[model samples]
Target chain A: MTTAAGSRTLAHPGLGEITLEGVLHAFADPMRMRVVRDLAREEGAELSCSYFALPVSKSTSTHHFRVLRENGVIRQIYRGTAKLSVLRRDDLDALFPGLLDTVLAAAARQAERRTAAGS
Target chain B: MTTAAGSRTLAHPGLGEITLEGVLHAFADPMRMRVVRDLAREEGAELSCSYFALPVSKSTSTHHFRVLRENGVIRQIYRGTAKLSVLRRDDLDALFPGLLDTVLAAAARQAERRTAAGS
Candidate 1:
């Protein structure tokens, strides 16, 4: 990435490199799904790793973000020691059409359903 | 009850019991995904376990199908000696709405893209 200059760059799958199974596996976990949902809320604005208050340990959290990046669901870059992440919305949409949005929306609905049931 | 009377029956998650992560995890595997795609092609008709010519062994195939059923992605029932399977499209659609169709369509597109690339 142009923004990845001068920092230890991370590897990500390009648009053509992403697969449906890989993306689904990355999203299958609750932690990774939370990161995706949070990034999607920003409307394309990149968010720092610290922005998401995950429930897991720091190392586990790192692993989650790495999975997301490696699966081509999100793009990660080191912006001066702050690893920022943003959903690869354009690429994912172009590759899978409505898959990402459908999953995200489904996730939101499930969250709401759980909350309602709990109440 | 009637169809399952004289044969072994399988338990499946009810509409309210299916979770987003559970469904995603079930769809994340290649073997289970193949079963899903095959079932989707049947247009809701229940196919027996042997209907899918999976490369995996019988036990492994059983495990995969069990994963799908437990996650609420598919329904399995035994008629005599054959365990028939079908996508829980109605239940899934009622709960997750367009999620199933979107994933299936994206998978079809991905398969076509891969075939074209290979050609």
Candidate 2:
């Protein structure tokens, strides 16, 4: 497979392979969870991989984005020079109702607690 | 920290540190997810770690259980010699409503599909 298709495959796992473990595995890392959170909160926003406030390198960021897409968490399409991403809200809701929102809410709470503790 | 508390710490991350990524990380591993699924469906039945049909050694099984509990996915309370485990339904539902159930449902479907494809 070429790099583009390979990346696409990584971009979205088929419905069959989109297990909860796979989805959770894709988002378990802090960076990846942050990426998904941004995607979840962004309304009609197609974010480029660079738009994230990640602490990783460019390649690592690319890798995280690819994992998110491949695990069926996010959908990606090439728009000129940037590969834009959006959460697979419909698909996710169909497979696991309320999970996306719950996780996002939990993450927000955690973020707030972290900030509060640091301050 | 002693091994018991260290292990307890592994058994449950505090409420403050429980994020989507952490919970997902706890369940991402197939073994751990399986354990969680069984716990979720047990309906008040507290299972022992040795009762699982895993492909790992005793020590690894212990480790997986530790990861699950520490992440707040399940509650581990010792009943004499046996460590009885139960899914922390209230806490999980509070933190991420319907996530555990959704993930379990998805996992069941995945298992069925895998079985059919293999046959």
Candidate 3:
């Protein structure tokens, strides 16, 4: 909620303003979905931007995080030099019950299937 | 599966090839989501494209339908002059478990919330 010096404040859409289309668009990208999956796995844990080991450029990962934050999928807060992100699970569940969990489950299933096929 | 004369065959990604990203992108558009929701509600009923009372132009509707079909969300078959579409519920359920149902439920909840808020 509060920002420290040199850390920019990020604008996030309120729960009321978060539309289904916006959330779907945010998760449509592979990178963004990966970030969401990781956040979901971490649950209550707040992760900094550098925590995610995404196979993309730093700017690209930043873009994906911004997309997720702007769409109200995650809440990003500045913590000194680190910008921490936490999944907006409560807001999303309240608005669209079972959606976030279902997406996470699907992602997990897909990942397992991919790993199995690869092995 | 079969196409009639003058009707072009639409290319659809097979169940094995359908990625979560593609399905999410297909449903990210409001019009396409509406189409999928309707298809889900009807279940086994196959309806023609003209059956959907969308607010968009004919071309735009066609494009949305194409996106859904190409992403493996729905199966569009040429039934004479009408291109009938049916939700690929089985394929999706097998691949992603409860994803389609969850999305439909979320859409319904959001619509109800919007209506209640408006009233």
**Taking the candidates in order, what DockQ does each have?**
0.83, 0.54, 0.75
Clashes in predicted model 3: 0
Candidate lDDT values, in order? 0.89, 0.78, 0.87
Residue A31, candidate 1: Cα error in Å is 0.8
lDDT of 2 by residue, A3-112 (tens): 65434323357676677777878878888888888887786589988899699889898888888888898888876567888888888887776677767776787787
Residues B1-119, candidate 1: write the lDDT tens digits. 67646556667888898999999999988888888999998897989999999999999999998899999998888777788888999989988889999889888899999999999
lDDT (Cα, 0-100) at B53 in candidate 2 = 67
Which candidate tops DockQ? 1
lDDT of 3 by residue, A18-69 (tens): 9998999998887888888888888888999899989999998888888889
TM-score of every candidate relative to the true structure: 0.94, 0.80, 0.90
Evaluation by TM-score, superior candidate among 1 and 2: 1
- Sorted into a CAPRI-style docking class, model 2 comes out as medium
What tens digits encode model 1's per-residue C-alpha lDDT throughout A10-97? 8888788999999999989888889999988888998998899998888988989988998999898887879989999999999888
Q: Arrange candidates by TM-score, descending.
A: 1, 3, 2
Judged by whole-model lDDT over C-alpha atoms, candidate 1 comes out at 0.89
